[model samples]
Target: MKKLLFLLLFFPSLIYAQNKTGGINWISWDEVEAKMEKEPRKVMVDVYTDWCGPCKMMNNTTFSDPQVVQYINENYYAIKFNAEGSGEVTFRGTTYKNETYDANKAGRNGTHDLTRAIAPVNGRIAYPTIVYMDEDFGILSPVQGFYKPEQIMPILTFFAENVYKDKTWEEYTKAP
Candidate 1:
């Protein structure tokens, strides 16, 4: 009983701390917009819904790793975006809103206009979508589902190194 009580108290705090570890640099949409107007860097958006299991997994696993955080912080401006929130977002001269969402309900929320405009052409719109973009806000890739730190390292590195500039992922991965 004593052990159970101790775990109940300490475990949650540990989990919370672990969840906040990774990602080198984090900024708000407003900051990203303002910076882009002056100097542009690539952006990474973790587009997730509050109730998504995989999204939570990302918070618990990938983001918690210090190495992962360090890499991201150095390379990109990371943004955590809720797909169903009452926030006004402006990207590339267009404004997006959560006009159709009623967050009070279960499993039903209006997607932002920005999400609609930038939906992946492959049509794999799932929970825990991580969108990568160039400095110009051009969509680079949309990775869906849960990915651990190991799984995401290459993708993260790919964007960081600007391999997308001269070659595709297939071409880049094929060499060496």
Candidate 2:
């Protein structure tokens, strides 16, 4: 009777824990550089503004998806960067900072220099951009928008496995 009661009480929680994604192991930009020296891995930067709704949605949904979390944790160094943050980040001998940040503002604050450096789309900053970089910190791509787990798996695999080298995206997607 006690065993049955214990199982009933704890089993649901155990199942929930197992089903839930453990979430990405995010590192700082500085940590990525440091880690690269010892062991190189692809880097995926999630550039988001705090005020952006889609950014929040992506964080809660797509980023927390089990498959997405597992693939990213296994293949890349994940970074979560606030685009409007005022912190200084030094990368590849260059210092990036948000000099024009205004705390009093709502919706849009000043942009971080690192955000500009990574996700520059014709001198504009977009929320929820995913920046992919090579092991050496070279830019591979900057994908903007909120992507579901199903939507993002292909992108993750393409970069993670270096499938972009020989196969075109069209070709890769068509493959059985």
Candidate 3:
């Protein structure tokens, strides 16, 4: 009884803190949208397939960076979405799903409609795309590729600070 009571008192908080240790608090699309309705915040969507190598590397490095994690948590609702995974999402009025997904082909299933909608780079789909969006799900950019912590920080801050509003990325990065 005492052990049960002790766990009930502390286990949840411990797990919550542990999850935040060197990791971003990745929420779902539904949750992010719901939260945005009540309290608007920027969003970062990590669209990747499970079999993507650079995607795994990004998860192991950039997303794990302490500074990156803290800054994203403070200013954005981060979502780690699987590009070829099962799920239904209704975004901007239309519903999306992996209609061509074959359970036997989990690793290389057809792309989810949500991924098609959010992660195309110049009309091409790429693994490990990092999409940034405004408070109302308006896409700011769908930057595709793997990046180290140092490489991603500037991009994160560019959106976080609204620098993209006044200056183009080239101009912003070129300035001293």
The C-alpha RMSD in Å for every predicted model, in order, reads 3.9, 2.8, 5.9
Against the reference, the lDDT scores of all candidates come to 0.81, 0.89, 0.90
Clashing pairs in 3: none
Give a tens-digit lDDT track for model 2, residues 64-170. 88888899999999999999998999988999999999878887888898898899766667889999999989998898888988999999999989998889889
Stretches of candidate 2 off by over 4 Å are 1-21
Give the Å shift of residue 50 in candidate 3: 0.5
Residue-wise lDDT of candidate 1 within 147-172, one digit each (tens)? 99998988998897888788888987
lDDT of 3 by residue, 1-176 (tens): 99999999999998667655758889987888889988899899999998999999999878877788889999999998989988888788898999988889746888999998889988999999999999888999999999998999999999989999999999999958
Regions of candidate 3 where Cα sits further than 4 Å from its true position: 1-22
Give residue 45's lDDT in candidate 2 (0 to 100). 95
Which pairs of residues have clashing backbones in candidate 2? none
Q: Could you arrange the candidates by lDDT from highest to lowest? A: 3, 2, 1
Misplaced by over 4 Å in model 1 are 1-24, 37-39
Q: Which wins on lDDT, candidate 1 or candidate 3?
A: 3
